[model samples]
Structure formats: structure tokens, C-alpha cells
Target: MPFKNDERELTSAIQAIQRDPTLRLYAVAKTYSVDHRKLARRLHGMQPRRDIIANSRKLSNLEESVLVQHILNLAAKGFPPRMSIVEDMANRLLATRDALRVGLRWALNFRAKCEDPEVIRSWFELVQNTIAKYGINNADIYNFDETGFMMGVISTAIVVTSLDGRAKAKTVSQTPNNPIKAMSQSTFIKTRIPRHQNSSPTSIYAAVNQFTKGASQIMHQLALLKAENQNLRQANEVLSKRRRAKKTRLRQGGSLSQQDAQDLQDERDVVQQVEQEIRASGGRKPREETRARRCGKCGGTKHNARTCQIEIDTSEEEGSE
Candidate 1:
């Protein structure tokens, strides 16, 4: 019967061989409960058969290395991508190479292998040490941090309205007026409402009788205003409930709003575009046309020294001497 040996067992067998150079392979294998042939292969520094490794991925070593580099670059750019985003990028790369499609398991394994916790901790320590040595302040650190272009871009606007249509007109407007001017106009309109003794019911009744021609019109307007005020109160209550629910959802990291979802999608698209640009550039920087001039003689990044008249004159003087 064929036996299976785990990494720990194999490692123990290798350690036994290292500790006792004169130890036989069969003895080491027996001690570690592994195969004698596997121990012999390990002692001979032979790699295991790739086809027999169940956890071996479909992506080639070179392709996996490139993907890992791409992921690290993105993380350094302050866009620590999600697994879904990584999977999408991987799928695109695989499709181009006509490789097998990757699943969630593959993505999980890729992350586990590429982003080892110990390696990440070492990188963190290095960064912390560098920061301490430089005595960098928060502002300087922020300047160095790479952020998305749409970091603070507005995604939505909220407009409150009442069913009775009066507040609706005030809330939703198309007039291209300055916000301050519009707000002042709204304040002026609000201030016109009676607040003193004139606002009393008895006073209003006396005024209605005195202005006989406008009595019916004034009563009708009062009825409409009362209905509008009731509608506004209800609308305010609904808005308050919605605000509370939104806050609760935000605290729990629940589903996003339509605008927020759209913004995230836009950011993902921007990242994809950047990745495509990087790929198209062949992983090398695009040469600057303005700084293309270089010295042909010494291969320096300055002026061409080969056809210089000054050098020609100096050469002629030396020849004459």
C-alpha cells in the first residue's frame, strides 16, 4: 500500500538526516513514519513530483510570481484589493494565457501562499523603522500615501420634499442661483409668516371680515397651508427614521446605497484601467520624450558628447602637440 507523508513528517526526516550525517535513509524514514524513497530523494536534494502534489495550482510559477508582484504593487499604492478584485484580475490574466479558470479556493490559496503573515509583519517592521528614522510627521506620511482619485468625490445628494407640494417646490429647484442667494430668499419668505399678536385666531378673524373681497381666498389659503404643514411634519418624521436606519447600517458595515455602490464600481473600473495601462507599458516606465537626449560616447543621460565641436578641437590640439 502507498503511504502518505505530511510536510511535518518530511521535515522531521530531513532534520534527522541533517543531525546524523551517517544515518541511513530507511532509518530516518522509519523514525519519521514516512517513505524510505521520499527520504532518499530528500537527502539527494531532489524535488518531489509536481503531478502528485494535490495542492499544486494550475498557474505557472512565472505567472504566479507576476500576479504576486502585481498584488504587492497595488497594496503599496494604498488600494489593498479585495479577494473578488484579485480573482477578476487573475481570471483576466489566465484567459489571455488560455489557462484554466480559477475558483474561490484558488484565490484563497493564492493569498495564503503569497501574503504570509510573517512576511507581512517583517515588512511592517521595516516601514515602521524607516518612519522612525526619518521622524516623519502625519502630514508628510499622508503626502507619501497613495490614494484613489475618487477618494472624496461626491456620490449623491439628498432632497427632502412634502406631499402637499409647497415644501417640494422649495426643496427641489432648477434655478441656477447662488446657494447663499437662494437660502436668503427662502429665509425672507419664511420670515413673512406672522409671529406676534397678529397671528392670533381672533385677529385673523377680524382681518378676514375687514377684507371682505379677499375673505374666501384667505380662508382657502389657510386650509391649504394647514394641510401642507401636516404633510411636512410627516415627511420630517420619515426622513429622521431613514437617517437612523442608515446610521445603524453604517455601523454594522451592511449593504451600501445605490450611489455608494456606483462609486465603488467606478473606483474598481479606474483600478482596472490602471492595471491595463501598466500591462500595455510592458512593466517598464514609458520613456520621457523631453528627457530622451543622452550622451552617445559614455552612455550617460545628458547631452551627446560624441559629435561635440569642443572634443574635436581638443583632439586636434593634442594631435598637433
Candidate 2:
């Protein structure tokens, strides 16, 4: 008679016969509804047909399992690889066989086929029947938009580690009082320092940590001060430019409007405030070479047009010529 059951049933029958010495192969086969001859053949070290077909594929069972684990890892990290990446992985695995090529749709088809439609249908049916039996309303049901993961079922975790195996990284513990116990759990350390009320290895480590933290805070404050100084310098330069414009207008015999005079007064107040701030911060105000007095007509420093020295010198030279 033809085999009445699948490979799984045949395997179970063989296992039953092996477990109980008294149980005959024919009886076990009959109980499982598998062919007695096929069960006997499998019991006698015959490999399953599926295993033979799997051996002919590009990736072995072990390699496939590892790749699936890698995918799950990336998914857990919220950066699951796309189908194209999976296709590339397949191509790399089949690199030894130049003639064999993996198609672009291979990964998608494999993923779709992995999900059992019967299992999914059963799950939905179970949920619907429960809701119907309990008389639950739609308002009571809630759906979370985020991905859900089962707690404690996943044993793997992602961690950062150096590539070198010999390099050891020290872990700082939040529990300073129990540093010894915590450090002992993670690493083996030989402590030469004797235990005392005030002085211990843990106390030294804690003190160093506190000092490092304080230094970091001080550095941060210094950075803020430097930035504030830069901002003040920029504001002062702007005010200086405005003052130059005002002086130029006044020198050209242009009367300042009320608004212009108010603006000039506001600029003076701001400059005084900036100077006070610089003095309070123990910083010297940077010299502004742009604000140096220069004659408008000759563009000469140290003398204005009213001083009339450069013009007099040029006139005497022209007269002599």
C-alpha cells in the first residue's frame, strides 16, 4: 500500500518504536498511520527526501538559520534590511556556483511563503470567537500603532564591543557603595588596599569620578563664557559702525533728527552696558582700529580737516614747484 502519512508522521512512528523496545515497528506504524516499510527505512539511517533537496540549495540549513537570526537582530534594532539586501546576501552565498543565480524576488517570495495562512486564519478566528463569546464591543478593543515584542522570549541583545579580543573595557557602576560587589560580578579584580572606614579602593575611584565630573562642568562654563564674549564683541562692532555713520553725518553739517539722536543715545547706553559687562567678567574690551580719528578729506590719521596740516604741506610743495 502507498504511504498514508507524511514524513513527520513517519518520523514519529520511528521514534515511538525506538523509545519502547517491546513496541513492534508494524504496530507503531499502524498507530501513526504511516507506511511500515518507510518507517523501517528511516529508522535504518535513511535520510529524508527534503534533506536531500535542502543540500542541493545554495545555503545549508545552518546558514539559513544564521541569516534568519541576523534579520531578526536588525528588525529588533528598528533597521530591518530591505528585500534587495537579502537578495545580495543570497548572491554572495551562491558566489561559489557561478552558474546559479538568485532572482530579485527570491527573498520576498521566501518571506511570503514562510508565513502559514492556516495559522494566521486560526489566530483571527480565535480572537473573533472570543470577542463574540464575551459580548465585547468595538469601543473596548484597542490597537497599538507600534510594533509589539514578547518579553523574556528573546534571549539575544545588541552590544557595543571593541574588535580586539584582548582589550578590556571597565564598566562604571551607579551603585557607588557596592562597587566592589558589582565590579566582581563583571570582572575579576585583585584588591591590595585594605578595607577601612575612610579609605578603600572604591573611595579612590569615586573621588576620581567626582573630580572628573567637576572638571567637565567647569569646562562647560568656560565654553559658555567664551561664546558670550564673542556675542558681545559682535554687538560692540555693530554699535561702532553706527557711531561712525552718525559722526560722518554730523561732520557733513547734517542735523540729527529726533529719532536719530535717540538712536545715538541708545547706542551709547548699550556700549556702556557692554563695557560694564566686560569689566564684571574680568575681560578686556578689544581695541577697535576702525574708530581711530582720521581726516575725511585726506584720509590721514591723527588729524581732522580742521587741523589743516596735510593741506598746508601740499600747498607749500605746490608753491615751491
Clashing pairs in 1: none
Task: Give all candidate RMSDs, comma-separated.
Answer: 37.6, 23.4
| Prediction 1 global C-alpha lDDT | 0.58
- Alpha-carbon lDDT, every model: 0.58, 0.60
Tell me the spans in candidate 2 whose CA falls farther than 4 Å from its real position.
Answer: 1-3, 6-37, 48-57, 69-80, 96-99, 112-321
Q: Write the per-residue lDDT of candidate 2 for residues 177-236, one digit (tens) a residue.
A: 344644543342223234444655675566556544444433433443454467679999
TM-score of 1: 0.24
